[model samples]
Target: MTYCVGMMLDRGLVLMSDTRTNSGVDNISTFRKMYHWELPGERIITIMTAGNLATTQAVISQLEERNKAPSERHNSLLEAPTMFKVASIVGNLLQDIIEERATDNGQKAAAGTFSASMIVAGQIKGMEPRLFLIYPEGNFIEASFDTPFFQIGETKYGRPILIRGYERDMSFESAIKLMTVSFDSTLKANLSVGLPLDLLVIERDHFTPRHERRIEASDPYFAAVSTSWSEALRNALDGLPDYRMDPAVKEILG
Candidate 1:
């Protein structure tokens, strides 16, 4: 299990994912879950994946290979004319992989053993920024004005803060700050979701990443944000009005 979030904003798109994967409590490892392909001024595509490691890696490797050598077997992410088509191709590929794995595993292939999903975000030269949450079944939904973000994997523990604070017009910097806090909440609540975090930003019409980075356990900014959020929560709790019995009602009852 892992956590990945992508936000669509008026300025651009912001994406984040944790780098932890585990087969068991003792068999944990770090693997990058975010991927991107860019053609400088032409297009930029990013994918953050969650689920079975083998399935996601296989999907990514196949995409990378196709991108390197354009083939009739599949449409390369680079060759897709629109972001919508790019997502369709990716979703189809993921579905094919899982189905193949099930066939190979025969009756032994239980549910979710070879399942995965992705958050796809990017832009083409003339198109606006777009975001999609692709499911394991090769279907997807685009982010809209009413829903400006998508989250994949161990989601419940971190969703509340995003719901309360997200704004579609927020700056990229502020968006990243919000994302970090979201990850912080997940990290504290779930052992399956751990650092380091990969972050990427694509500004409107740039056709290239505006910001990309990885935040490790020792990252000072993340450390400070985590500390500050804890303090803020405590302060908020303290400031809330407490419930008390009405004095007149208590006296009348007595």
Candidate 2:
């Protein structure tokens, strides 16, 4: 299991993902689930993945290989004309990989063992920044005014925070803070989604990342945000009006 989120804001985009991957409680490992490709002043693309590790790795590797080899320019992420086309290319590659894996193993296509999903966010020269949620079936949906964020993997635990706090016009700092709270909530509820977390922030019209970092277990900012969020939740709960017994029930009991 893992947790990955891509948030669309007026400023640009913010993406974060957990590093923990586990076969069991005793066989956990850390693997990066966030990747980015860039062509300075032309375009920048970021992808956060969740699901079968092998399938995700295969998809990423193929993209990287195509990116490096000039002969594969037709399918290269760097050569994609628009963010929408880039999302389509990635979705198709992801779906094909899962299907190929399933068939090679003599199982039905997209069997549970070979399924994965991705969030693709990026901007191309002369185009608006876009974000997409790509599923294992080669179809995807873009983020818009109605749905400005996408979450994949172990999503239930952290979605409430995003739903309650996200704003389309919020500043980048506020967005990152909100994401930290969301990730902290999930970390407390699920062991399969542990840190260190990879974070990438892409500013509007900027073909490169505005900020990128990995938040380790001991990162002061992360620790402070986690502690602060926990305290805030408790205080909010305490401040809410308490439940009272019905007068009729009290009289009957008396």
Candidate 3:
């Protein structure tokens, strides 16, 4: 399992994903799940994946290969005229890979044993930045005014934080802080999601990443954020109005 989040903000876009993958408690490993392709000044595309590692890897590898081929192919993400088209290409590729794998294994695609999902976020020159959540079925939904964020993989544990804290116009600093809290919440709840997270911040119109870094277990800022969030949660719970026992129920128990 893993966790990846892509948040759309007025500033640009913020993306983060954990590197942990495990087959069992005894067999754990780390693998990068975030990838991006940029055509400086023209466009920038970033994808964060979760689910069957092989399926996601294959899809990414094929996209990379297309990127390296001639620009005339028009099959490359770089040559796609808009972010929508880029997303279509990625979604189709992801769906095809999952179906192929399932067929090779003599299993039904609906079995979902070989499924994967992705969050594709970035901007094309002359357009407002966009964010999408692509599912295993080759279908996707874009982030908009009502939905300005996407989270994939081990999502439930961290979803509440995002729901309560995300804002469409928040600064990048605030977005990063919010993401850390979300990721930290998941890390505490699930052993499958661990440290060494990859983070990328793309500023509007830059067509390139404004900030990119990997937050290892030892990263100071993440450490501080994790500790602070825990304390905040405890304090918030304690500060909330206490639950009072019903008098009749209490008397019966007594």
Candidate 4:
């Protein structure tokens, strides 16, 4: 299992993903789940995947191969005219890979098994930055004002922080802090999602990544963020109004 998040903000977009895959407790391994394609001032695309490692890797490899080929189908990421089209290409490729693999193995493909989901975010020249969550069925939905972020894998533990703190117009610094809090929540609850996290920030209309960093286990900044967030949460919880039962209710309970 893994955890990946893509947040849409007025400043641009923020993406993060963990780098761990395991079939069993004893069969753990490390593999990057984030992939990016850049065309300098023309376009920039980042994809973070979660699901079967083999399936996701195959989909990415195929997309890269198509970009290298001389095909005219506009299947290449570089050839995509809009961020939406780029997401469509990726979603279709992922669906096809899962289907082909399932057929080869003589098993029926279902949404829960071979299917993989991805978060695609970036911008093309002359377009605004966009973020999408592509499902395993070759379908996707874009992030909007009402829902400004998307998360995959072990999402439950991390969702509350985003729900309470996210803003579409937040500064990049605040967005990163909120995302770090979300990630810390998931890391504490799910052992399957381990670190060495990949984080990418794309500025609006830049058509290129503004910042990218890898947060390892010993990163000082992440460490401080984690510590501070936990303390803040503890303090907030301590300050909540205490339960006070009415006299009649208390007497009944006694």
Model 2 agreement with the true structure over 120-155: per-residue lDDT tens digits: 999998999999999999899999969999999999
- Tell me the lDDT of model 3 at 128: 90
For 1-254, candidate 4 gives per-residue lDDT tens digits of 89999999988999999998989878888899999989898889999999988889988888877546556334388888888999999999998988887777766545456878999999988888899999988899999978889999889999988999998889988898888889999988989998889999999878778889999999998899888987898899999965557887666666
lDDT of each: 0.92, 0.92, 0.91, 0.88
Residue 76, model 1: Cα distance from true site in angstroms: 0.3
TM-score of each: 0.93, 0.92, 0.91, 0.91
Q: Which candidate gets the maximum TM-score versus the true structure?
A: 1
Q: After superposition, how far is residue 43 of candidate 3 from its true place, in Å?
A: 0.8
Q: Kindly report which residue stretches of model 2 are placed more than 4 angstroms away from their true locations once superposed.
A: 66-75, 246-254
Q: Model 3 over residues 1-254: C-alpha lDDT tens digits?
A: 99999999988999999999988878899999999988899888999999999899999888877556565344378888888998999999999999888888887644488899999999999999999999999999999979888899999999998999998889999999999999999999999999999999999999889999999999999999988877898999999966658987666666
Question: What local lDDT score does residue 158 receive in model 3, on the 0 to 100 scale?
Answer: 94
Could you give candidate 1's per-residue lDDT for residues 56-149 as a string of tens digits?
A: 9999989877546554444289999899999998999999998889778883654579999999999999899899999999999999979999
Query: How far in Å is the alpha carbon of 111 misplaced in model 3?
Result: 3.5
What is the TM-score (0 to 1) of candidate 4?
Answer: 0.91
